[model samples]
Target: MTHYRIDALRQTLVLAAPSDGLPHCTFWGARLPDGADLAQVAASAALDLTGGMLDANPELTLCPQTAAAFPGQPGLVVRSPDGTPLRPVFTKAGTKRTDTLSLAYTDEDLGLTLTFRFAADAATGIITASTTLDSDTPVLCDWLAAPVLPGPQLADQMIDFAGRWCDEFQPVTTPWATGIRARDNRTGRTGHEHFPAIILPARGCTNTGGEAHALHYGWSGGHRMLAEELPDGRRQIQFGHATASDPLPGTRFETAPLYAAFSDTGLNGCAVSFQRHLRDRIVTWPQPDTPRPVHYNCWEAIYFDHSLAALTAIADRAAALGAERFVLDDGWFKGRNDDTTSLGDWTIDATKWPDGLTPLIDHIHGLGMTFGLWFEPEMVNADSDLARAHPDWILGPTTQPLGRGQYVLDMANADLRDHLFTQITTTLSTHDIEYIKWDHNRVLPYNDAAQTRGTYDLLKRLRDAHPEVEIESCSSGGGRIDFGIMAHTQRVWLSDSNDALSRLRIQHDAALFLPSCVTGSHVGPRTCHTTGRIHSISFRAWVAAQRHMGFEMDPRELTDAEAATLTKVTAWYKANRDWLRTADILRLDAADPAIIAEQQQAADGTRFVVFAGHAGTSTQIAPRPLRLTGLDPAASYTIDLANREDISSLSRGTPALKSGPLTLTGQSLMSQGIALPYDLPDSMWIIEGHRA
Candidate 1:
């Protein structure tokens, strides 16, 4: 048995290990901040807010229970709700968790205690972590842990604050049979319901409700999350939590998100994900000179059964639109349709491109638009030439464990890496390849024998060999987006999902972690990648304005009038490019009851606002002169013509001129309040005002 004591008056909480001594897994000293009430800290900065990294050896930051301020001392006094400040200090050595950390908060009044726990799971060689909230008061158990991955995997723990948390080492009876019936050992209550522990190896596992709550389910990575309450009423989990594989051990290992998640609460979870990634990986962006994409991309028309004539059509269109770069997506290589076959053959397919890629690239460059090509270099099909040619190079044992599935190329083997490098690098150097979109489709699968150390060098070698080439990352659409990848690539594909409403959150979360200039959000048409249902065009326009805007649709499908509008918007974006590229964005709620998005000045005294109406609802936005955060209110400025829907509509419709107050009270929905009779979801008014 172990006993714990707290010196509440002095402001220190201490824990004791079991007297008989528990083997392995050492725990560190625990302390609750002074002036911090355990109850409040648990909600906002509980265990979920704390983090552990392979880099930071000692120092730790934790969310104490909510009480405002917490005093600091090596050993003082603190109390728990049950008067048992059982802050257990452990020292488990020679075990899997070589490094460890823990944080917990308690409050007698609210009967709440918040706690966070994390440590390296050396056995799995990936970090195994989790978070939980405890209450002496009545509530179900709330907890979450990193989901497992297919092969050897890393662990991540995501958490949301704003409540109390407590560590629960206390054992409890798990559910019996299939029902939520468990024995509450503490309360002696039978048939107690508790949230089932999440089980995820491929994706991050999540759970919540300080009490039992919702069943965990969602697409694994690269999306935003709505705040969800578990079946238990005691806890809630939102986005802003992440985990990563043990960075390929090297000087340049990164621990940031390959896929980021943003929260509905407006928290920039992507930023948090990457900031943590920086803990392990080297950040190699803004490569040397001022790095920027030479132009936009048009890959759809140029991908499938397109001839030189068809490709040139896209090239000509991109040039007319002032796009300086054109990228050729899939179908250039020999035999690639679905994920079924035709990889590893980097050679140009004679059937599609009898003249090779150089001619099209040469044609593009001749038109002043640089050429870029796509390649999934890391993955190969079993029937591909590379695999057929060198069966031994595939990752497996000599005994031939080919029994279950197809073979995998062992990047760990120097010979394999060098061979693949020769093929890929030769293609890049032979042609004037300026940009490369490196994609990886599947996760790694190394049997016990086929693996080796130093996998991180794969990217470094590829990039060092061709430093001048700008790379864009896409893993079947962003499963590979991360700072480690960003070090070499110029930008990343945000998502394959081009729908606007979906983009609002996707782009919002993506930009939070990545800079707007480095992003390539496209102004895709309503009939986007999948659904093909046309959404509010304004929504596309708004999402496009937030980052380095482009489009993914066939320009031929749009009506002449819509094309003209796109041209107009493109022109305006180019003119005010600095506003978004170098501005601070602050979202405000408009009087229209819609999501009011606004951007402050970039390099000047200009401020812009976008007021998007609710889906299918026509609403009037009451003009509120926002106290611009980063603008000079004393200076006078003129609002641009395209920014005002009133002016743009009048200029488009009546061929008349009209000027009124900053507030568009008397104007019609199309004029001032930006309508959504359909889903004018991206309808807005960009207001550039006089500083005074």
Candidate 2:
């Protein structure tokens, strides 16, 4: 039999591999500076080693759980409990190189992780790293109860937010997820489901006034992970590669790559998700001051007849219905609306805004509405005025192999950051811009400047400059929609996919861990950029309620009836938003064909149950009339009769469910708790039950 040993002395952690075949590894200078309790420091290191592995894997090979929990002389070891050697012997393993580095250790049996902080009384704060985990057997990940689970308050916030997500209408009701996975012996990776895990992003970081470090968790690279803290107290995770063979790219793309921060995660980088998890816990959710308009938009209006009159006409229609805000989207920006030309120029196109955007603004405002504008300030056209004027200003690589994009700014440079910041700030501050829909068209085309990583610094600087702007982040749509992005930005366009049914899936999955205000649902047109599926009028507003709702279609063409429905729904959201905003969400079940996650928030004596779902009620037997989990049933209450269609259905089928009394119970009828037979597809019922 082979054995493993680990020891923690002050800031040093030494793992001694069995002489039989496993090699031992020693890591020193592992303690936090400023002299922590030496014993506590040692215990912390041991725990980090034990738990880090366990956090990543639940099924263990050995009974190292107890040993890791109480590390001293022999330390702790993990192996297959069924006496199967999980990994092969690696008596002499080769060393590897990586871009970034961090370390994490886990207990195999108990499934625990012990993430190390600073080394105890260590010499260098810069942190040097080394490790030796043998190539033995595969360990199945299972980190159910790690010390770092976001606290109860954060968890509750997530549940509440998730409930709203569920409440949004989804045709399939079942939580739908699609992802691409690599095939062992295939040409391309295939998309698969039944996910082992998922990543949910609420809003692209809403620029809250705070430190950059606070939002950061870890970085990835070289298989090593490093975590860091910015001056403002926000956390960031860094990633490093796991091996030393080849230098890894620091570029951010969606693949299994290493990231690093400064934490004790030794994958050459930090894990991609730890800081994101932390960010999800701390950001504050701000409700909309005014009920936003169920707007129509046009990025496609380019070359598709987006004249000022057409746009005003759209605004006119939206206004007639009492919508609060009307946004004149893209094509209006200086010479834009195509894959080329006029990007750096932020002026309005006279060709498009003939009466000067002021008339449109005045008219929209005259109609008792605020006006919004869109800007893709991150990129530049190779032939734009800004590029031609200040050629050196654009970010470019000195050497060859520069990726795509004709013009990119040097965001890392202070002058450039200030330049771009001033431009955007000036525009946003100067105009009747009640709302600024900020979009980042691309991640980064090129950052090969000898100076610094410009794009990220530029964003951080912009966040600092425009703290109060109601900014929306759009990297295409789903890109960069992380807590880091949300910390500075208020809302994120949920997806380019605005089809209400599709939104049900995107939003239901998104809301589980995001703030309610972070979700962005646009009352998209009959067909647009994503999915191209048109939605019913009712389903549009039903799902849009998940987050800040807007319009993504041409406002002018909506039928008077469509406009009226929009007006009514907007009013409804405005009237009772308080209930939805502050309620606590309880995810009732995850396996239903239509997953049910409900929210209950109390303001006065009224308790609101927001039943968020994926599929309509037809999946189950009228859900047992939804025997609400926490309610004083005997108390008198008034179920909001807002759902007339539901009223009609109950009257016809479930005749037992009468409004006058709480004692209305009927026998199982032909109609289960499904949406009314002849009602709209995605509708929300604000059932207000009170302690009568």
Candidate 3:
């Protein structure tokens, strides 16, 4: 047998392949202790047992089987020449690299060959596994998986997400029972309900406690994250592009890669690993040297009002308020007065602009703010010119349910996909647009896998053609957020609801895996359009400024005081954004669930930016004191207020920040939590700390 070991971000993943009989590979998860003997540990580890180096009993990373062999949950199930289930038999295995292994199998009965490809990053502890099945004989494949690992039955706890549109990333925990726990998003897109992730906590787990092994699917289309615990105490976890492909004779079918990461420092540790992988390896956009702009999007402000004069007036106010990106959302296209028409038309509304987008684009550029536009490339209304021209472009049946008064464009069709590529690339070539708010409003009605590949291909082509254009993935808000989409886009619109209180929870949950720099956190209007809840400008700006700062309101409508507050917040984010973009996020576990504190620490351990916020939830006479996390133990630090607010003004009786620049050791601040003001429940605090 041969062993492959890869160490990544404090954790280690080991893959084993048998020398002679059945060249199946098994995955083992473990913590990388300092100066441990890798060979000694791999020698004692068993493929099916849990403990030692093999903390996890993951079946072949890509389990290809048939009904005759290892029966249930086979990685690949294809019909034999006799129209029966065919299983793959191991042929040989080879060591590709120290961090990679390749295993090949063949099904003589079906004349098919299946090969598994596995690779791991030694820095992020993220293992990516993919497979390809080739044949000269045509066969009907029931289902195919990228990679499915059998989890240890000892992992008694499981965590996943469930939510709707505005309420996204709501974590749900359940004890591992006998039956199967399946999360299927058949919406043909990464549905708003559940993100493609699963975490198995060791025995009993807390936010920062216990060991966590997490798996995230890299495909964005309809996906399945499943965990099935059998009667023999074996648990199988599978995730991939939730569909099968029928390979033609002499053709090859491949599966997308699935990512797996493990951490002993609990869920947050696993999150940190994933976040590092995304920012450092996966995300394609180049991080600008300056801070991400405080964008002013005119979706809520203008909606369908797209006259050049009206947009110019709004752009002036946005620039005055220090908005760096002015996005003219929807209704800028030909004959697009509402969502009912003009989806696939890329041309500007000549009536609205009189000439073209150049007038408004030039005006926005003159104001020292970049210009952005909205595009729903994969959607077409029945009333659109593109749909009218190409009637067969829509995916699904002859008649399908419509969303936002439109049907999904079938990118699976080569002709339709090429047309979309032409329209989008043409628009980019013609305009000096800096950003695109790419929106996907509806779900895929049927055969979503092809559509997903088409979407990815289209984006890849767009990126290659226009490398400077940045794209924001907005799937009706929080619908298409995963490592798969992150590989193609810049930022995600966190949620449609900009109500600060709602965002406090949503942003907290999203930041678990998504870094603050890639999350679109916007300060909406005082009266939130979705929730109808009003919030103070101080509270709203405080929440949004901490992330990829932006505004979703009309700056011209804001009061003078509110406008000034917006400007100040934008300036503050710009000054501290360098550290914010690169810091390791540490989410503190508070006794009160309502009190959320996130600390961003610089790599050198010299600086820290702590953002703390609380919803209007009070217990007894006061709210609980907040404790910070991830600080140097013995280092002395100076805590200074961002806005120069005195400690007394913040909290009535707390003495921690009464004097000028409260100085304390990092150990003291973490061990003994700081008391916060009970009166200002809606407000948030931005405390800066520097090693002194």
Candidate 4:
């Protein structure tokens, strides 16, 4: 066996090529100690490769469960032109780069050439696997994967998430049972069912300790993630294109890279690693230096009540509240009074604004705030003129249920996609639009992968054309968030349920794969439109500050005290956003599951911010000491509480907060956590750390 290894970010990926007559490679996931021998480590952990050649033990293969072998669920399955199974035989392989490895295989009978590639990043500990298939003659690929990982030992627990439209990223954990545990999302969009991620916690891994292996499919559209434990003691985790596509002969097809990472420091460690990797390596297009403006979206402020005078007034108030971007969300276009009509009509409503949107747009610009518009380009109402003119453009058997009185356009249709792009481009080309809140309110029931591919193409083309404009992927609030869309979008609206208390969990789970910079968190109205829960302005703003900060409420409704709170929070975020955008995220564990605290640390260890979430359900009056993470233990620090005076509790004999910032050693602070005062229920606090 020839062993190859890539060491990165305190992790190592070892690949072994079996010289025996078997057509299988082995992958070993090892947390290498210093001066470890790659070959020796791999050899000691190698699987027993003694089984029938046609149906061998899956644990021995780099990609377990091949179609010809174990037969439960193959990572790659292809058929010949004659409709017979086609399996490739290994030919040759080599290292393309220090971080990348390539292996070639061919199915001569079917005239198909297959090459698998693996790449790793040493600093972030992210490993990616992908495959490219080229065919000389026509062939059909039922399914193809980027790379499959050999099942790891001591993986007795599984973790995944599931939620609906308003509530997303609800974590679900189960004991690692035998047989295939497949979690798939076929809803044309990423959907509300499951996030495109899966995790297997090594036997005893907890929030702060244990080993964790996570797999994430990078595609934004439909995708699948599975954790299968075969009867033969092989536990494999694989993710691939969930959308079905039939490639023709002479065509080349490459699956999106499947990213996997390992961590021995627990789940939060994995999350912090992922956050840093995505922010630094993947999200490279949108300049990190570009200030993420504190936006005031007019969605909850005045839904479907768009008018030049009203919007201008809102813009004035927004500017006063320190809003840098004034977004006119929904109902600005022609016949767009409700969700029912004018979806495909991109023209500005002349009836609502006699002159056009220029007056409002210019007014917003005059306030020193950039203008953003709402658009649902891939949707159309039956009452829309575009839909009437092209009835067949609606994707369906014409029997699909209407969501929000709308149907998804046939984005897969080239002509329809071209027309929709033209309509959107015309608005962007004519207006001084700096941002677009691209929304998709429904799902495509029909399994058409081409629709997703086409949407990606359209977004790519638009991005290429207007590189200056930033787009937000908001599928009725986080329905279409993945690395694929993250590649094109600047940020994602985390959820439509902006209730601060609920947002705590939503944002917490989102950080599992996304960086705080790309997660759109906004302070909504006092009474959330979705949950009807009223929360304090300070709490809302505090929760939002930990993310790409923004506001979704009407500033005109704010009291003097509320305005002051908003201003204070906005300024704090602006002052610290540089580090917040690129910092490492640490989700602190507490005895109470309802209590949430997150810390963001500057990479240089110079400063950090901690946002503490209160569900107001704890029976203990003092709660507990809130310890911090990602700090330089050797350094001295000064801690300042943003809401110091407001820190009062109903319990008697509790001490008041200090008048000024307190100085202490990082070691002391981390080991013996500072006591936080609890006030009202559903409250929040911002604690800052500065190097002393």
Top candidate, metric TM-score? 4
lDDT of 2 by residue, 26-124 (tens): 222233354434444334423232433334321111112332231211112223435332322222222222432223343344333323222111211
Best candidate per lDDT, number?
Answer: 4
Model 3 / residue 208 / CA error / Å: 2.7
lDDT of 1 by residue, 1-692 (tens): 23222322112222332332221111111224545453343234212222432231221112211122222111112233344443323222212212544444344454544443433322111232333334454432211122111110121222221100111111232211211221111110000111112211112321110111111211122211222221221122222112112212111111112121222122222232222333223235434344243355555443456477777876777666556677787667886654556677778888878888878888898988777888876556776788888777765543444321234466567887787778878888889887877665544443211121223356567778887777777654555444444555666676666666555555543433455666667767557665465765555665676666776666666676666666676776677665555453443333444454444344344455433423224254322232223333334433333444423332233211134333222122112333222223445545443333
Sorted by TM-score (best first), the order is 4, 3, 2, 1
Assess each prediction's global lDDT (C-alpha) against the native.
Answer: 0.43, 0.41, 0.76, 0.77
In candidate 2, which residue ranges exceed 4 Å CA deviation? 1-304, 387-408, 445-468, 527-529, 590-592, 595-597, 603-605, 609-641, 646-652, 655-686
lDDT of 4 at 624: 80
Write down the TM-score of every candidate. Answer: 0.57, 0.57, 0.93, 0.94
Off by over 4 Å in 4: 19-35, 48-60, 65-68, 81-83, 87-90, 93-95, 243-250, 285-287, 649-659
Off by over 4 Å in 1: 1-295, 337-339, 391-409, 443-456, 536-539, 590-641, 645-679, 682-684, 689-692
| Cα shift from native, residue 189, model 1 (Å) | 42
- Cα deviation at 67, candidate 3, in Å, is 5.2
After TM-score superposition, the amount by which residue 190's alpha carbon in candidate 4 deviates from its true location, in angstroms, is 1.2
Q: What ranges in model 3 sit over 4 Å off?
A: 20-27, 32-72, 80-83, 152-154, 245-250, 286-290, 643-651
> For model 3, how does the per-residue alpha-carbon lDDT over 519-605 read when each residue is reduced to its tens digit?
898889989999998888878997997688898887777998888888888888888888788777777777776677787778678
Candidates in order: C-alpha RMSD to true structure: 14.8, 14.3, 3.6, 2.6
Model 3 residue pairs with clashes: 58-150, 63-75
